[model samples]
Target: MNYKLIVVMLFLVMGALVEGKRLANLGHKLKQEAEKVGKEAGHILEGKVAQKAADVVFNAVLRKG
Candidate 1:
């Protein structure tokens, strides 16, 4: 019974780790896309205010961790 419980716990931990990794990857992709869009928008707009707005979005999409 104890060995079975340990095995189950191990599986749970592994699953959690996999999910965390997937989420991290997703976040990275989101940031990359946001940056690309932000840059494109800034170029298209061609104004200080628009560039500032794009900068705001780019910074907001960045993760601190």
Candidate 2:
């Protein structure tokens, strides 16, 4: 019934919606990246180099993305 409480509740709801969308997009991107990495990793390299590349790429993507 109070004006201040109504405004605060509306702000909280709007924030939750925005944050939920960003989180959803991030989750979707991670899934797609994981699959892409898995497929690409299976090709065209030896043991240590392949392993190192995968580690480096995965870490970089996870960090930057």
Candidate 3:
């Protein structure tokens, strides 16, 4: 009886460890995807800001002339 109980406990612990590793891997993947999306968004916003600044400068030059 004691031997059976020990085996059962070992299986439970092993299962728990496997599940924990899976969750950690999932969390890491999600973080990488989020970083990728953020970088893409940053590039898009940077382009728009540059265009707006150029337009502002062009308009100012036209007014001065």
TM-score of each model, paired residue for residue: 0.68, 0.61, 0.86
Q: Pick the candidate with the highest lDDT.
A: 3
Compared with the true structure, what per-residue lDDT tens digits does model 2 show for residues 10-59? Answer: 99999999999999999999999999888777663566687999999999
Ten contiguous residues minimizing lDDT sum, candidate 3: 1-10
TM-score, candidate number 1? 0.68
Best by TM-score: 3
What lDDT does the true structure give each of the candidates? Answer: 0.92, 0.92, 0.99
Error of 2 at 61 (Å): 44
Where's the lowest-lDDT run of ten residues in candidate 1? 56-65
The predicted structure with the larger lDDT, 2 or 3, is 3
- All candidates: CA RMSD (Å): 15.6, 15.3, 1.4
Q: Model 2 off-target regions past 4 Å?
A: 44-65
Pairs in clash, predicted candidate 2: none
Candidate 3 stretches with Cα past 4 Å from truth are none
lDDT of 3 by residue, 1-65 (tens): 69999999999999999999999999999999999999999999999999999999999999999
